[model samples]
Target: MQYYYGNQMPLRLLDEAEFWKHQEAEHTEVIREALNGLEPEYVQALKEWEQALTETHQQVVSYVETVNRMGYTFEELQEQVTELIKYCLDESLKFIDLCREIEANSAAAKDNPFAKTLLNHIIRESEYFVGIARIILYGHTPA
Candidate 1:
């Protein structure tokens, strides 16, 4: 996706990834219904996801200020961005783990296909951000 930077994001997957990541709001109903009969813990997991995502967003905003207005040295900016990336990765991994727990044994499995599909979509999005972080840390861009 043009909105994401990563070392291994395949060109063909860009549009699909963009649709899922950037346009997720359009499919809220589908997601909502998918969890209709699921265990409430799944709902709680999603709440955690929201919190994690919000925290990551805030970190990014703060880091942007540091880079733009605070006049951070290049190394300082790099360190800050790296910290932000680590925070995002840590939070995303936690959410994914929670999803796996819910998926393993819950009412969410009632519609197994839908539940798995939704989980996969979320996992892919998280992976994309992690990829960007890893690429940046390695000091290179995709070719």
Candidate 2:
């Protein structure tokens, strides 16, 4: 006797390639502008975070290359890729939180026109980054 289950929902694997492409195409320019408008300290923080991200990306690439050269099994490579994605997602969330903190503090700081403008830009940018972070972590595209 065959046990019947209700209508099965097709599981969609996270398409990291498509996600990255979309982010690069649609969000990079805004992020760049926001980074440009940040205060010095915030800029430094972003730079450091970006450096870490770059290193993580390089590590992933190296792992994939090594796996290809050394003839690792698909499962082993998938596991490594999953770990790298998790690490990058964690780092992205940390950067998002840092950006939020910077935005909040900047907004609360003394109000000079220039300072307010800068802070507003940071606030906007932080919100966007937070959305991106959520998308990366949860695999649900931001609306």
Candidate 3:
């Protein structure tokens, strides 16, 4: 999350969204792989999450390709990029909620120290993305 794209906020935000969403989708597999004895409900939930995250990741990738190819300045495409950022923000928040639920409610997650810690880490990563998205969309983060 570098502000290196001082004039390319949309590209920067899209790149971030693309990377994190892909990571999150893979994280679902990581969790699934680690917890062989996980409950069926939790496993199914993770599978659904993986699919959702992957779809979001692909959407972000499409945006990135379009933005890079079109060469539009941030001002030219701010509205569309803003909508994308908002969608990403909502997705990240929902992901954090799901991770928190697993950490708090899943017996499998509760019993495995690794899974619990990993869930916390995953939530923090999504929160970090949310914070970045807020800063970009609102020009400042709320206190």
Candidate 4:
């Protein structure tokens, strides 16, 4: 989670966001690979998610580089980074919903227990990231 970074707080959170978004993007492929007979619609959705997550991951990485290059988190960029964290949190929540939908409605996923388990695992991981992001954005007690 790495939430406490003193002056490098934004950098730390950005690092976490980058890693998790990349993981989540890879998770879409993991779901596709785990489910042998996934519906075309579901597969297409996962592919889109992968692309989106990857783009978000890249954005976070860019922020991380900016922070490092500047040697500290400036006020203007800090606000933007905070918004980016919020966006990442929202993206994670949406990804979780998509995973839940597949678990509940996908015919191929229903036939494959491993995919279901993987989905659950992936959802939990994303939820953890959400909790961390909330802590970073809204403090220990998020509304």
Best by lDDT: 4
Quick one: best TM-score, which candidate? Answer: 4
Residue lDDT tens for model 1, 43-138: 655655555555555545555554456555554444545565556556555655765666677775645887788867866665665565455445
Error of 4 at 33 (Å): 0.6
| 22 Cα displacement, candidate 2 (Å) | 12
Regions of model 4 farther than 4 Å from truth: 2-4, 141-143
Candidate 4 residues 70-116, lDDT tens each?
77645657789889999999999999999999998998877677878
For every model shown, what is its TM-score relative to the native structure? 0.65, 0.50, 0.90, 0.93
Task: Give the candidate order by descending TM-score.
Answer: 4, 3, 1, 2
Give the alpha-carbon lDDT of every model.
Answer: 0.52, 0.47, 0.85, 0.89
Please say which candidate is ahead in TM-score: 1 or 4: 4
The sequence of per-residue lDDT tens digits that candidate 2 reaches over residues 1-143 is 11131111000112342233233223223443544345666656655665665565556556645654786654555555555556655654565566456655653334445544654554455455445445534656556
Q: List the residue pairs that clash in candidate 1.
A: none
What's the residue-level lDDT of 94 in candidate 3? Answer: 87
**Model 3 stretches astray by more than 4 angstroms:** none
CA shift of 81, model 4, Å: 0.9
